[model samples]
Target: MEEKIIAHMTAEALYDFTLYHTYSKFAGFLTNVLGLAVGFMGIILVVTGKSPAVSLVFYLLASAAFLCFTPVQLKLRAKKQVQLNPEFKGETEYTFDEEGITSLHDGKELSYSWGQMKKVVATPKTIGFYYEADRALIIPKMDFKDRFVPIMKLAVEHTVPGCVKVR
Candidate 1:
């Protein structure tokens, strides 16, 4: 009934994230394919010898790649890191009944029943649970205890897109 969370996560800071397990290996696969595309761009910039815009385009592509993938990569890395070592320990065991979610990470806690849940999604490496329109709780596997098990069937009821189908 208790769960934990990580705070102040950053690119440089390394932490295990359980969600990384869902996608790290796959990320590697994507990295190779994407790297090849980058290589093609490099060839266009070098082998073909185009205009000054070529260099600008190269820089733009590099910047775009960095901007697009770093956070996602870090999310995966942090999840993996949490899988190795956790930082936050959220107290999810307070209560889930009518009084609802009394434990707080800092000093704030909200009370809500399962009926309040709106959506749930298990992406490549992260499990997302949406309560309202814009708020969500993302949990990674590495954040869990070593080999912790989940009740996936019941958990599916709370995801945004219901990625986990209960049988």
Candidate 2:
């Protein structure tokens, strides 16, 4: 049986998905952990009066820099998505079957065999099909009328090794 999905990509949805994907990676996790460690050490130094002012300043600067960087980068990427794919502003239709998936966007159609899909990355609100490490086709979860998660899972199983679902 073929499953059909029709959805529109919004900037907000894309932004959320990008942020989720970014922080779910090892690098992002490490950055956050290091930031917290630095912050705690700063606090400890202040309490102990060992270079208190310097430690506090360094902690604040480092924490703020790391925290603000991701959001800003995500915002820029979201904006670029809008600018680059004016076609995606409208509804995108996807048809999935045993063999592969076909997508129709802004009057243009493209088909991809199951084997062509390298990976499936799923989040609570979206599922992204990565053809390459840096390129993906993102679909919002809310776009499906029914059986959203199961359908995606089945698709991933059919096409790729496994789906990586991020919390």
Candidate 3:
């Protein structure tokens, strides 16, 4: 059976999804952890008078800079997406089934088979289907009228490997 869901893409949803996607990678986690560690170590060194104050300042600033970069990147990406696909600002209709998804926008239809999906990420506010590492088709939770969540979860798990559910 085919299930249809209609939703609009909001900036907040895009930001949240982008933030999650940005920091969910192994490298991102590692970098964040390492940055914190370096900053902490720099603080300790400064307190002990073993290292120059400049060292501490540099480490702390570097960590802060890295932490601030992701949000800026996400904003740029979202802006570019909006600029490139002005039609995406409107309502999107998605048809889902055992095979894959079909999206209707501005009288144009696009289809993606199950095999084309790399992952399906379900969050409290949105469900994102990632076809590429940085690109996704986002579905807002408010769009569902019935028990679509369970249906989406089942279909995703059956079709995609490494499906993630974020609380």
Candidate 4:
């Protein structure tokens, strides 16, 4: 069995991953949900002829902008990060075994033990190995082709107990 996979990273993929990584968290999800709710409530009030105040409308617009524009901002940021960093543009190879993972890209190699990961999160389109609350090593599902399932299983098996979440 092949224990290695190679992925060609792209700006679009990076942006999508950034959006998912940010919004998949409990806090970020809740904040966006709240913004949506507030915006909808304002709309409902205006439609029902029970509009509160102009200040409330402004507040609602602000919330609506937060809900709508954050992803746009993140896209711009992700694009900039990918464009400015030479390490993210090419094919990165990840080799894994029972012990850990080694990634090689742009003539640089990095190794991380399974125990070094803070958590592993498996979503439908990506698997993320987080080293910190806000930092992760993402494996895009498409990059793995038909091997995503086995790779996910391997990650779950190797990561520490109670640190893997499948969503």
lDDT of each: 0.46, 0.78, 0.77, 0.78
Residue pairs in candidate 3 whose N, alpha carbon or C atoms collide under 3 angstroms: none
lDDT tens readout by residue for model 4, 81-109: 77888767778898877777788998899
The runs of at least 3 residues in candidate 1 whose Cα sits more than 4 Å from the true structure, single-residue gaps closed, are 1-42, 51-69, 72-108, 123-126, 140-150, 157-167
lDDT per residue for candidate 2 within 25-126, as digits (tens), equals 898888888777877778888888886576698887887777777888898898788668776588999988787778998888988777777777777677
Clash pairs, model 2 backbone = none
Task: Return the TM-score for each candidate structure.
Answer: 0.42, 0.82, 0.79, 0.80
Q: Compared with the true structure, what per-residue lDDT tens digits does model 1 show for residues 4-112? A: 3343333233323333333456675576567566656666666566635457567557646744575566677666654553333333322223322233445666565
The model with the greatest TM-score is 2
Weakest lDDT window of 10 consecutive positions for candidate 2: 158-167
RMSD of each: 8.2, 2.6, 2.8, 3.0
| Model 2, TM vs. native | 0.82
Residue 139 error, candidate 4, Å: 2.0
Error of 1 at 157 (Å): 5.6
Model 1, position 149, has a per-residue lDDT of 43
